[model samples]
Target: MRMKRYPFSNKALKAMIAATVAFTPIAAFGGGFHADQVEAAEQNLNFTDLESLVAYLQTVRKHLTDEDIQVLNEAQEKADRISAEDYVDRILKAPVSEEGRALFVATIDFITEVNLLEAKKEDIEAFAKEQSPNVEAVFESEGTSITMDQYLTYVANVEQKFLDIIQLTEIEDLSEEKHAIALTRALLSAKDPSENAVITKTILRNINQEEAPGAIKELVQKIDPNLSAAKVVVKALKKANEKPEEPTPPGNGGGGTPGPTPGDTTPTDDGVEVTPVVEANGNEVIGTIPDALIDEIVAVVTPEKDEVVINLPKVEVGQTVSLLIPAELIDKLKAKAPDADITVQGDGVSYEIEVEDVDTAALAKKLGVPVSELSLKVSVNPVPSARALEVTKAVQAKGAKVLSQIVDFSVEAVGGDKSVILRNVGNEYVKRGFGLNANVNTNRATGVRVNDDNTFSAVPTRFVTEDDKQKAVVKSLRSSVYTVIEGNVTFPDVDKGNNWAENYIESLASKYIISGKTNGKYGPDEYMTRAQFAVLLTRALGLPGADYDGRFKDVKGDEWFNVEGALMAAVKNGVVAGKKNGTFAPNDRITRAEATAMIGRALNLSFVDFDKEKFNKNKKITDFKDAKKVGASTREDVLRAYQAGIVAGTTKGNFEPTAFTKRDQMARILAEFLIKADLMSELK
Candidate 1:
C-alpha cells in the first residue's frame, strides 16, 4: 500500500512558513550536505522538528534516493508494529539514517499540529474518531493493535515529543526565523498560556527582534488578541513600519541627486533661518541633519564648597553619555538635587533630575554660592529612554551597591547600540541565543570595566533573570567590585552581617588572622589567591617560624613578608607544590577543588580521623548530579571532605569542584574545618 501523504495547501504553507524545519530525507544519492544549509533553508520555509530530524533534513537538502525512502518507510512500518506502550521507546531505539530521523520528527510534528488546531471540540472528536479506523488498520497490518483511547493519548502527547525534539536539536544551527516560528507556534498551541508565555518570550528574546517582520508578525497576530504576545507583535510591526531613514548618505559620494545645497536655508516658524549641516562632496551637499532633529543633553554638578566643580560635555538627548566623578561628589549631588530619581548601580549610584523650571540663581544663593560659581558645575539634563530605565531596574534587582572611591553613571538610547557580550559560565550547556538584532555589532574585549561604554564590554542584550545566568552575573560583578578590602567589623563599607558566613568571618578576624584592607573595608566576595589562602591556612594552623631560601622563584625577598613565612611553612609541610615552571604563583586564585584538597592535607597533618568508607557510601557526595564532572584524582578527596562536614558543595546537589574559592568562602571553609577538626576550641 502506498502511504498517504497529506500536503498543506499552498496558501496555508506560505502563511505558516517563515523558516521551515520540515523535511525527511535519506542519504542523498550525491552531493555533500553543508552545515549551514538547514539555517539558509529556514529563511524561506515554515517551522518545526529535533537533531536527528535536523541532520536528516540537512541530508535531504543535500540529496536522497528512492531506495533510501523505501528502506526508511519499511523501518517506520516495522517500528509502528510495536504496542502503543512500547511505541516511543521502539522508535527511539531503532537504528535509522538521516532520512529516518527527519521522518520521525515530521510524523510527530504533523500529529501535534493536527491535535492543536482551534476547531470545535465536536469536530476534533469526530476527526479523531474518523482517523481511528485507518490508524488501527495500519497497526493491525503490522500485527499490533491499539485502542481508540491509546490513539488519542498518542495525539495528545505529540506536543511533548515535538518539545523533546526541539530540546535535542542544535538550535544554534537553526535560523532565527525558524526558531521564532517554532516558538510562536508552540506558544499559540500551549494549553497553559501563562506558563508557555515565559518559554516563548525566552526564545523570542534570544532572537529578539526590534520589530517583528512579515510571517512573525502574522504568527504573533494569531495568538489571543488580549495577550501581551499580541501587543508585543503589534509594537514590533509598528517599529518595523516606522523605522526612519537617514536624509542622505554621507562622505564624498558622486551618487544620484544631492540634498539641499550647502548654503540653502529654510525659514523656521519664528522667521529664523536655519541651514542644514551637510557634508560637502564637490559642489553637492550630502548627508543633511536638520536643525529640527537636533536634540541636546546637559549635566551640572555643584558642590556646597568651591573645591572642585565639573561641567560635562554636551551630547544629543538620544546619545549615550558616561559621567565620571569622585565618590565624595555623591553628597554634593544629593544636596543639589534632593528627592531626585536615584538608581544604585555598579561602581556608583546615579540620580537624575529634570532641568525644566529650576531657578539656578536662587539654588546657588541657597547653597551659599554665587551664580557664576554654581554655573561652573551645573548643566542641562537629558531624559533616558524607557528601555534604558528598564535595564537600570533589572540591574538593581540583583543587589547593586555603590563603588568606594569613584562613581560613574551612563545612559544611552535604546536602539542606538553597537554590540553586546553573552558569556555563559554555568555548568550545564546552554544554547546560544539569536543574539542582538541586525542593528548591533559585537566585538570581544580583553578586559571589562563598569561605566566604560566607549568600547562594548559588559553590556548584555538578552538577560534571563531568575536563572543561573543572572546568578552568574551577580557573582562575577561582586568579585570584580573589590581589589582591596581593609577594615574591621564596624567599618561602614564592610557591609556587616550581610551573609550567613558573618559569624565565621568575625571569629577569624577576632583572632587577628583575618584583617581588612587599607581602605577600611573587608571585601568578603573577593577572590582568594594562592598566597592569600596559604597565609590564612598557616595562621589558622598556628605554624611558627620564617625560613626563606628562595625555594620557589616567584617567592622573592623580604618585601614578601606577609606570605613568605606562610609559604615556606606550607611547602615544608607538603601542603602546596609550585607550578611546573618552578614558580609558586602565590597571586593566582585557588579553585574550590584545590582548596578542599589542601584542607584534607591539613586535616591529616593534624591527626583528624574520619571514616573514609562512610564518605564513599554517602549518597550526598557519591550521587551528586555533576559528580562525573569532578576530576578523577580529587573526586574522592572532595567526597571525604564533604562527608566529614569540613566542606560543602555550591548548590544543593552539585559540587562545582572547579570553581574558584572567594575570600569570604575561604574564611567560612576555614571556620568549618576548624570546628570539624576539633581545633575551634583550642583557638579560643
Candidate 2:
C-alpha cells in the first residue's frame, strides 16, 4: 500500500503541539507470552486525538534514532494495523519507566547524530522501506506502535517546532540561535550526503534569504563548501531543471579567498617596493607602513656644498626647526619656502623653519627625486623660556585652567620706545596675526596695548596726555582672543571705566568656562537668575542628561538647553530644593546668600568627602563686621562660601549677604568654586 503524507501548516502545527502536550504518555513494559497478540496489537494500535499522538511522538523525539525513524517509516509502508483510539490509549497509559526515558534519549541522540530532519525525501523513503518491519517489531515488543503516516507526521511536527522556536526568538539575540545553528551545522557536516543534503539546502536558503548577520553566513559556508544551499534550493524549484551552479571556494570575494597572484608586489612613488594593499593575514586587508619609514631621522643641521643640501637620516613630518642657513642662502631658502615659518630665532642666530609645511613638492622637484625619498626633520616649536615658566606657575597658583603651554610664537621687530616684543607670556602662543590685549608694566612705565597684525606701532611720546593714554588703552582692547594685564585678566569691557569684577571675570574666562557675549562684551553688572545658576552648576559637574521630565511646574516653556533638566537634576541629586511654594521660581533673581548656599551644596555633592564642619568651623570671613547680619538660614553656607575664597565682601568688613549677584560676580564665584572643588577636569 502507498504511504499517506500529512503536510504541516502553522496553525495546524500549533494545534497539534497543544493537543499532544496534554497527554504525556509515561511508558511501561513487562514480559508477555502472547507473541501473536503483541504483533496483532502493534498492527492495530489507534490514535484517538491527533494532537495527543503528536505530543507523545514529541516526548520521544529527542530519543528517536535513525534506526527508530527507519522502523516507523518501514512499518507505515507496510500497513496500519492499529486504530486511532487504541493508539492514543496505549500512548497515554504508557508509564514513563526508566527504559522508555532511556530509549527516548537515545533516539534523540541518534537523530542529532544523523541530522534526521535534513535527510532527503528519497533517502527517507528508502530508509523507511528498509527498516519499517524492524521499527514495528520493536514497538510491538513494548506493547505499543504507530503507522508510517503517524510517525512521519510526528517527525515533521518536532522539526517544525524547533524551527519555530529559533524563528520567534529575538533576531539580534544570538546566544541561543548561535548554539543551535552551530550544533546543527556540525551534525549536518557529519551526516551522510543522502541524510542531510536536503536539510542543509533548506537551512542555507533561510540564512541567505533572511537579513542575517555576517556570522550566520560564515556558519553556512562552514557547513558545506561544495553544495551552495541557496543555489540548490533555486535549482530544485525550477520547472525545467538545470544543474545547480558550483559553490565558490569559501571566503571568495570579500572573504578569506585570495585573488590571482597572492602576495603580489607593487612599487610606491618613492622607489620602495611593497606588496599589494591586500595581504592574506587571516583574510583581512590591513594598511602597512614600509619598514624604511619608522623612526626615520633626517639631519640638515649643517649646510652642504653651495646648495644648502640636507642629509637623509629620517623624515619627520610636521616638524619646524630653526635652520642656521648662511646669509647668501637665506634668500634662496626663503624663496623656496615663501609661505613657511622662517622667522628669525631670538638674537638672529638661526631662522625658525617649518620643515613639514615647507613645499616638499618644490623641494622634491629641486632634488630630482620623489618626495618619499626626501628625508629631513625640522624643529617644530621653540624651547620654553623663563617667562613661560613664570606665567605657568602664576596661572596654576590662581587656578588649573591651563590646558597646554606656549610652544611657538612670533614677534615684531623690537626697537622703538613703545615697540617692545612681548614674547611668549600666556597659555597660548603669541603668534604674528594673533590679537591680544595686554597691560604692560616694567616699573619704568605702565601702559595697556594691543599687538596688531604682528606689529605694535603704539609709541608713548612726550606729547601724549593721561586721557590720550586711557583712550589708547580702550581702543586697543576692543575684542581679542586673549588679554593679560599685570598678572590679572583684562576683559574688553573691564577697563578703567568698569573694572569692579575684572579680576574675577578674567579668572573664570581663563579656566575656559565663562565667556563674553558674541559682541565681546562681558556684562559684569547684569543680574543672574536661579535658572541660569542651575544650568551653570550642572555644566560644571558634567551631569548625565541635558534634559529630564518636568519635575517643576513653574519651570515650563524654558526651552534653553539644560534649563529644566539642570534644575530637575539638581533637585533630584539633593543639590537644591524648592521654596515653600512647591514651585521652582527659576526666573527670580538669586541673592548672594541663596547663591552661596547652592554653591555649597554643589561642592559637597561633587567632592563627596567635603568637610562641611571644617569649612564652617574655621570661617574667618575676611573680617566682615556685617557677617552677623547674614540670615540664619544661610549663615553656615555664607561663612563656608566666604572662607572658600569664592565670595568676598564689599571693599571692607561688610558681608552683603542679601545683595543680588551680578553676572560677573557669579562668574568669579563659579571660577573659584571649580578650582576649589577640583571640577575643572569635568570642563573637558
Candidate 3:
C-alpha cells in the first residue's frame, strides 16, 4: 500500500478513466461535459441564469489556484494603475454603453468568482417537474410577462446550447435526439408534457436511421391488422413516432410514429428514417414544442463583495534560504539527504525542508517567503499524482473528465488516451456506453495511436502470448521454404483442410517452382535447415557461383550431405554461408533472432539501436503487417528483420524468440517474402 501523505488518495487523480465495475451501484461516471463547456456556459451572457452562474464561476476560475491571491493582486494593481477605458472595452461586449460593458465585465468576473466557491451546490436548489416561472422571467427580461409558449422556445434554445456542448451535466436522458430537448426542458420546465410530440419522435426513431428499414418492416408485420393496402407509408411513420401516453386507435401497440414509403431515400434532419408502423398500431406520444417563441432564462442579481486585500503591518523579517547550485555539487547534496533526515523531492539541487522546532520567524525564513503570506491553515488545493496529471491533460484536451473514483493508476498513467487508458466509470450502468459506438471493449487493446481527429488504431495490433517464441517461428518459416523447393507436394486441399496454412503451402508448391521429393510428400513438418533453404533460393535466382563453396568451417568434405545441391544452390549463389562469429549453428534451430540476422545479412540493410533497452527484442512476431527486414549477423539483426517485415509471428502472432527453426516454416516465409518483396507474384 502506498502512503497517503495528504488527506487525498495517492491515486485520486482528476483524469482517471470512468470504467464500470461489477457490484458497483448505478451512477454516471463519464459525463461528456468538459471544463470548457462549463466555461462556455459561463461565457454566455444572453441567458440570465447562465449569466449569473457564469459570473460566479468566473470568480471561481480566477481563484482556482493557490497563488491566485498574489497573482490577482499584481494584475489588479496593474489594471488599477492603468485604468484604461479602452482596455476595459476590449474585455466587455455589452451593447452601446461603456458602463454597461463594465457591468458585463463585472458580471463575468463575479460569475468566475462564484465558480470558486467550494460551497457551490450546497444550496441544494431544485424545481422538481414543475416549470420554474423565474426561468422564463429572466430569459425574457420580464418578471411576469412571458407566456408559456415563449418560455418553451427559450428552453429549446438552452437545450440546443447544451447539445452543442461536447458534453453536458449528468442527466437521466441522452439516449435520443428528442431526449436532448426533453432533457433541456425538464431542467428548466416544471411540466412534463404527456402529449409532448418531441419526446416521442426522439425516443423511438431519432437514433435508429441506419437500421430503420428493418425495424420498420418488423413493426409493420407485428401490427399487420392496421395495414390493409392503400395507406401512405408516411402516415404509418407518423404513427410509429408517437408517445406511449397518447391514445391510439383500437391499439395493439408498441410506441411508433408513422413509417416511410418504399421510395424514401434518406433519413430526416432529426436523424430518423421513416418506416411503416405495421403493428395493429404502434404507440404514439402527444407532445409538441411550438416554434416562433423565444426561451427566457432569468438572472437574480446578488450584490456581494469578493476578495479584498489590505495593507498589512510589516511582518517580522524571517531568515532567508537561497536555492542556487552548480551541477558539479549535486552529488554532494544528494549524498547528504538520507543521513540528515530531510525530505528533498525535486530532482537535482536538493530542495528540501526538515525542522525539529519551527518558530514563526524561522518558518518564514526557511521557506524564503514573507511572514505576511504564511497562513496558520496551510491549505494545499488537491493535487493528483504526476501520472494522473498526464491523464488530466489528455482528457481535458478531448473535452472530457474523469469522474470515476478508482485506485488503478495505470489508466491515468497511460495518459487518459481511450486506446491505452482503461476508464473506471464508477458505475456499471453507464460504463456500457463508451468509445465511438460503445460496442468495442477498450480494455483488451494495448494502446491506440490516434489521428488528429481523435480516431485511433490499436497499437501492436495483436496481443502478446507466452507461446510467441521467435525462434520456433523462424524454424517453421525455413521448413516451409524447403517444402516449396521440392514440388509435386500432394496435400489435402486447403479450402477443406483442418490446418489451412500447411495445406495451402502444399497446393502452392508448383506455383513457387518447388519440386518436391519423388515420394510425393511435402514433409510438411520437416525442419528447413539454412543450407536446405539455399537450394530453394538458388532455384529462384540466377546468381554467380550458384554451386559450391568449400569455405565454411562446418561444410567440409565428408560432412556435406546435400552440399552438392545446397552448396551450388547457396554458396555459389551467395544465398548464405555463416555468421561473423564463424559458427553457422546450422543444425541448431533458427530463431526469429537468427532469422532476423540472416535476413539482415541477405538484404545488406543497416539496423541502428538508439534505445535498444526499452524495446523488448524478445517480443514475438505478433503483427503480420510487418514484413520488411534487414538481414544482419547480430542479435539486433533479428529486431531489424522484424521491424523491416521479413518475418512474422505464428497462428497466435508470436515469433517465438527462443524456439527452433523448421524447414517447412522457412520455405513458407521465403515464399511469403517473395510475394511481399514484389519479386514474385502471389501464387494463383
Candidate 4:
C-alpha cells in the first residue's frame, strides 16, 4: 500500500534553510545539530506519518557526526511527540506565500528582539555594541546614515510600532487603511498633540490620496466622533490632503524629494512659513502650544500677592489646549498652586486642562451613597478667592475643621481619568505635635475631597518635608474641592494603653490595612492562622492579587483568602511557600519563626551564612537563649529579620521559634518591619 505524502511549501523550505544556516555554528560547538543532518531530514519531509518520519530520522543517526546525530535526535523527538494528523494539518495550514510568511515572521521576530533587548538592559552598552551590525543593516537598506543615537531611536520606533501593530491585530478583519487610521488615532492621543499632528500628517501622506480622507472619517466615527484625538486626526488629514507636493529635487533616480531636515527653515509650496522641528531626546519635537495661538489666552498676575489668574478660551469637553506662561508668571502660579503639573518646554511653560461636567451618579457610587442623595452644586465663580476667616466660617458650617490654609487649585488628569498627585497639599500639622496632644492624633491628618453635600471622601495622603517645611501629599482620581482635616479614629478593644500594639493596630486600621474581628472587637491575644497572616502581609505591601489563581492543594479557590487573592499573592511574591507535601496548611497556626521568615522574604533580605561553629564563636544568636531551637530552614531568615529590627526576643530572653504568633504580636512585628523598611509610605 502506498503512503500519503506531505510536502513542505516553498516559504517553509526557505525558513528551514535560513534557520539551519543561522544555527549551524552553535549546533557544531554545542553537539546539537548540523547542516547535513537537517538536509537529510528535509529529503524525508514527504513522510505523512509522524512515526515514519521519526523512524527515518533515527535510522540516519548512526551514519552522522556527533552534531548531526544530536540534530537528528531532536527532530525525531519532535516528530514522536506529535500525532500524524496534527503534523499533516500543520503543514497544510502553513503560510503558502512569501509575503504571508514574512508578515508572520516579522511580528514574531520583533517580539523576540524586544524581549532580548529588555533582558540585556542591565548591560545595554555591550548589548547595543553586539546589535549594532543588525541595526546598521536596517538603516543601510533604507539608504540612511546610522549613528549610536539614531540606532537607539530606531529601536524605540520599532518597539512602538510593534505595540501599535499588536493593538490593531486585536480587531477582527482590520484593513490596511484602517490600520493606518488607528495609528493616527494613537499618535493624536499622546501628550504632545503638535508632535502627534506631524506624525498624523505623515501617516496620511502614506495612504492613497483618494481613499485616505474617507477611511479616516469612517474609522474615527466608529471609535468616537467627539474624541479629541479623532478631531485632531480629521483636521490634520484635511490639511495634509490640501497641501501641494514639493517638486522633486535633482537626484540619481526620480525618487520623490526628501522631507525637510531637522532645523531646516525651508518654506513649503503654499508659501506658508515652515517651523523647524527640533530633535530632542531622539524624538521629533514641537512646541506644545502654537505661536499663532499664544495671544488668544490671557494670564494676569496680581502685584499685591503671588497669584496668577488664567483666563482660558472656551474649549470643548474632551478638547485639550496648552498655554505658554512666562517664567515669572509660572513662579507666581507655583507659589499659589504648588501641585499644578507644569511642563517647561523650551522657553515656554505649558499645562493642559481637560474640561468635563461632574458625573453625579459615579461620584455617589464611589462615596457609597445613593445617586438621589448627591447634592450637585456648581460655583458661579470657578476660581474663588476668599479670606481666611471666610474659609474657616464655610468649613465650620460644613461640620468639618480645616487644618491647612485653604488650597484652591484646579487638577488636570493626565492620560484621561488617571489619578493626579497633589504635592504639598496641606500645612505641616505633624511638626506642630498635633498627634502627641492628648485630645488629637496628628497621624489621623488626611486629605479629603469636599462634596457638595458637605461630606468628603478621604484621599490617599502622605507626609514629606521639603526645605524644612512639612507638606501633605494627596492623590485623587477626580477633580474637586480638596482640603486637609485631622480627626481621631479608635476601636473599642484597641484603645491607648490596652496593649503594646494599640498604636500600631489603630494606625493600620485607620489606613485600612487591617480590620478588627466580628462586632468591631479586635482579638489582640488570638492566635493568627497562616492564611490570616498572609492576608495582612499582602495588604501591608499593597500587592495587587485580584487576578491571582490559587496554586496550593489545600487552598481552595472559594476560600476567603484565596478568593481575595491574598494567599495567591503571597505565594507569587515569594513571601510564602507551600509545605513539601504540596499543602499550604492555610488553617494551621503560624509560628513566630514562620512569621519572621515571611517578613524577611517580603523585605528581600539576603540569607546569612549559617555555620554552627562560626555562630558559636561569634555568639550571633546568643541574644535569644533558645536560638538553637530555630529550624535550620528558617534560621537565616530569623537572623535577617532580627538584624533588620523587624523582630525582637520575648521579655524572658527566649526566641520561642516554635510558639504560635498572636494578633497583637504580629501587628507589632509587621508595623516595625514597615517602619524599618521605609515601606510605610506605600500604604494608601
Give each model's clash number: 17, 37, 140, 1
Which ranges in model 3 have alpha carbons more than 4 Å from their true place? 1-489, 492-498, 502-504, 515-518, 547-549, 557-565, 568-575, 579-586, 605-632, 650-654
TM-score of 1: 0.27
Local distance difference test, per candidate?
0.36, 0.36, 0.28, 0.41
lDDT of 2: 0.36
Name the TM-score of candidate 4: 0.35
Compared with the true structure, what per-residue lDDT tens digits does model 2 show for residues 1-684?
A: 622211111112111221121111011001000000000101112334323433433443444445555543433332122222212212221222332333333332223222222334454465456545544443343334544444444444344333322222232332322223322212222211222222222222222111222222232223322222222221222212224799877845575745434222222232122221222233122222232222111111122211122211111111123212222223333344332233222211111333322344544454565545443222213222233334333433443211121223322211112222223211111121111111122111111122332111111111112422211111111112111222233467875657666655654454333556677777788898887777666545434333556666676646563543656666666666677766778778988888988887766662233444535455575477886777777776666667766677788668777889889779768766765653322221
Return the lDDT, model 2, position 388: 32
- Candidate 2, run of 10 with poorest lDDT: 29-38
* lDDT tens readout by residue for model 4, 1-684: 532211122112222211211111111111101101100101112333223322332343334445533433443343234332211222223322333233223322322223221123333455456545543443343344344344344233322332232232222333333333223222222221222222222222222223323332332232222232222222222332234888766754855754434322222232112222222222122222232222221122122222222322222111222222222323333444443322221111111221112233454455555543333211111112223224434554443444543333333212223323322112111111011101123355555555554455454455555454345554443444555555444667779687877887777665555678877788899999998898888766644455556566776677898755767867876788888888889899999999999987876721111222322233356689998899888887778777776677889999999999999888888877765654444332
By TM-score, who's the top model here? 4
Best lDDT among the predictions, by candidate number: 4
Measure candidate 2: CA RMSD: 30.9
